[model samples]
Target: MADLSSNAPPNQIWVAVKKQKVWIASGILLLLVAALSPDQARDSLGFVAQSLLTTAPYLLLSIGIAAWAVATGADNLIARAFTGSPVLMIFLAALAGGLSPFCSCGVIPLIAALLTMGVPLSAVMAFWLASPVMDPSMFLLTSGVLGFEFAIAKTLAAIGLGVAGGFIVMALAGSHILHDALRDGVGNGGCGAAKIRNPKTVVWRFWNHGDRVEKFGKEAFKTTLFLAQWLTLAFLLESLMLAYVPAETITSVLGGTGIGPIAIATVVGVPAYLNGYAALPLISGLMEQGMAQGAGLAFLVAGGVTSLPAAIAVWALVKPRVFTLYIAISLGGAFMIGLAYQGWTLI
Candidate 1:
């Protein structure tokens, strides 16, 4: 018989490394330990399960919204509309993003595509910052998990920051920064190219167009593929967070006394890039343990906005200066909002 260990494939060599084996073995051991310690495992598992559950509704809503936006060609129309007037574009972009239910990852690709189609950088930035926080899915989750008052507060805070940040970016960078990167005539292409029928003439097209079934099938396939690619990275990040971070750590850092908690929470959250679903349990736990509302809100905004994947994606697509500006704007906005929440509560 062939020597099984000696004949292992090259790919399996890395997996057989002592360090890797030890790490894997240690992980299994830790899991067993946690399982034996029912109370600790229960708390940790509960936190992760709750996080997943809270995020599920928002994920579904966001995917549906994104699919509709793509299928109806609303994305292109909105980009074109914004190109006409910079100020109007900023407001409309934020409004559209705020109302839609897309998470940060789901929205990033769409925003990147829009930028590639020549949408204003300021408007794109506003949408990036606002969408995850103000979207209906987030609103529903926030209200469901926290309460209506907290949801309303979050919505208003996100909008205010989005608008203000858009204006600031526009003033500093100029609209030209975005137009230079976009594909030529991206928005100007007629909807006919995509075989999109006018909403008013949908009935007529259904009756007249013999290939309507084929066209519908094509649209569905494209939308599904687009959504799958969009969500893949985000889902991976959520899984990692669920697997690694401890609930007590989240609660302690975010719930500590004074501005220190807010600062620590912001620092921890800014780099995480988790969706509200992955973040909900952590935030709820902090709140339940007497973490300041303002700090928890800050963590949510920071985590929602500045994901590492989105940052890397942005960096690859835009100029270094532009990408740096994007990160700064998001961080600054989160800090300001957190500060405002703190101030309001103090008053």
Candidate 2:
């Protein structure tokens, strides 16, 4: 047999490597970690493996749903469902987002699907801004750790933050200030408007058509690969973050009153986020250490919405403009919500 493994041209090989950049970066980081400290490397890799295992079921479901939408042509229905009543849709999205089951990192699939399906960015923004903050289980956990009042306040904060952010996007869109939401090569899309111009009739029984079945398989595989690569990198970075950053360092800076501390908390929350389950106890401990109530709320809201992992996933899905607006809304609303909550506590 002729050894013809290097068949691809150099440029094509470079393009392929660029596409796999996240995986390459992940490998490099791991190698560096292993070289520097084998124990830390082992711990971080273990964390990534465990996180992936925990997230597997949700990832599979998301992939299946995404693939199903494409195969069955049900994406049009999804668009109509979300865009039927724009104002109502935004409100409902915010409300539903509070009860969403997805975690900060897991919400990316739906966000991408909604954008790809041409769902109005306003409603999607509402859902997008809110989904990461609080779920029913998180509410319970926050209640147990921080107290029922604080949990209720956080839940309300999630809904309110989303509603406000949605309307802001809607207003910007009205002024033509908002840019095209999705990125290139995301999904049957360049911009959502162009794709939804000629909506296809959804065939619920898509399996009856061989082409549809093939489409489903391809979509599923592509989605699975895309999500897996990004998710692995997200988890790997998250693992490193948790291992290196100390809780005391985070709490120390956030433990003071006024807008100054709240402002600092919002900024710090992005890099310092320890995930919902771990952060509650940490925040609770910080409160006992004199962390301002406002700072705590700001930290929680900011971290939940724009944590390193969640931000990375969002960056992968949307254009830079949309991502910037998303971060702006998160940071601004988190601070305001914190101020409002602080006022409420004073009263």
Candidate 3:
């Protein structure tokens, strides 16, 4: 009775529009194509629709696993990665981080919890570095877009980068340079800390618990929306690029098998990278255009670890010097891995 509509948050329709902006943008692009070139528009629609259906299985599997981790409270089990010897901890942390399906935003609170609890920086570094690069979903999607061999290679790269970063921090532990790395005034992950500090028993039978079942539904919906929005935008862009961008241009700029293209790809990746899922189809397109295999791999690795959001998160938690070290390791490791992968391709 008190003009309740006036005080209500922006119209639900508008709120939804904002949330689904990427899809909207994609829709607009299709409309323009329909106006300018009706034939191509039909082909584009077919390509996008068919591509989505083809990848549907992979997306469903990834979403289920990710939601299961959340609903079962298995995400809180990251503490297990730190329980062994320093060297062993590094290995497990790296491997677990690579396999875990935690999103960038979700990983933040957990990392805060880990550092505040005095988890050794070496192992923490390992976990942090690897977590962004690969996860079960990423592996499946990459396999769908790229190939099994490349997906397998990227998984190894994630673990390898994590191990190298961890050991480097371990060696530097004596200097105490990175000691107490967190910036002042950061909350100890707030409510998120409790889950890590005292992990709850994971109920794999999440359907039995009303709360967990609800959580799974919400998480699955969220993940599905996230993947669909980004993938739709990606496939849209892919259609346009294939329609307009010349193979000669992509080939001349990014083609060839050598250190040069790989290095260039790594550098460009820092800026041009879309989110992990969105990047796959674009890289696949470039490869079809003669982009070097090593370059593609380097771009994926570099982008995964050094994207702006990832960098900002690391910078916020640690001192500038520690941030610098993270960047150095990420870039250097990406380059070296690219070279190694290039050599392997030749063999």
| Local distance difference test values of all predictions, in order | 0.60, 0.75, 0.86
Clashing pairs in 2: none
Give stretches of model 1 more than 4 Å off.
Answer: 1-36, 42-84, 102-109, 174-258
Superposition error at 338 for model 1 (Å): 0.5
TM for candidate 2 is: 0.60
Residues 26-142 of candidate 3 have per-residue lDDT tens digits of: 899999999999999888888888888989999999899888988998876766787879999999999888987665676677777878887788998998789878999999999
**What lDDT tens digits, residue by residue, belong to model 2 across residues 167-226?**
998888854346666778776434343324555688999999999999999988977777
Residues 1-347 of candidate 1: C-alpha lDDT, one tens digit per residue:
22238678765665556424433543564477476765655555454455556555655564454444444434444333245588887887777656653424444445556565556777877776676566665676677667777888788777776787789878877455543544333343233223212222223233244465455456556544443333333333334444566657656666544677777777778765455554665466557656778887888777776766556656655676677677777767777777778778777
**TM-score ranking from best candidate downward:** 3, 1, 2
**How many Å off is the CA of 148 in candidate 1?**
1.6
Better TM-score candidate (1, 2): 1
- In candidate 1, position 111 carries an lDDT of 57
Cα error, candidate 2, residue 55 (Å): 22
**What is the lDDT, from 0 to 100, of the residue 146 in candidate 2?**
76
Model 2 lDDT, full chain set: 0.75
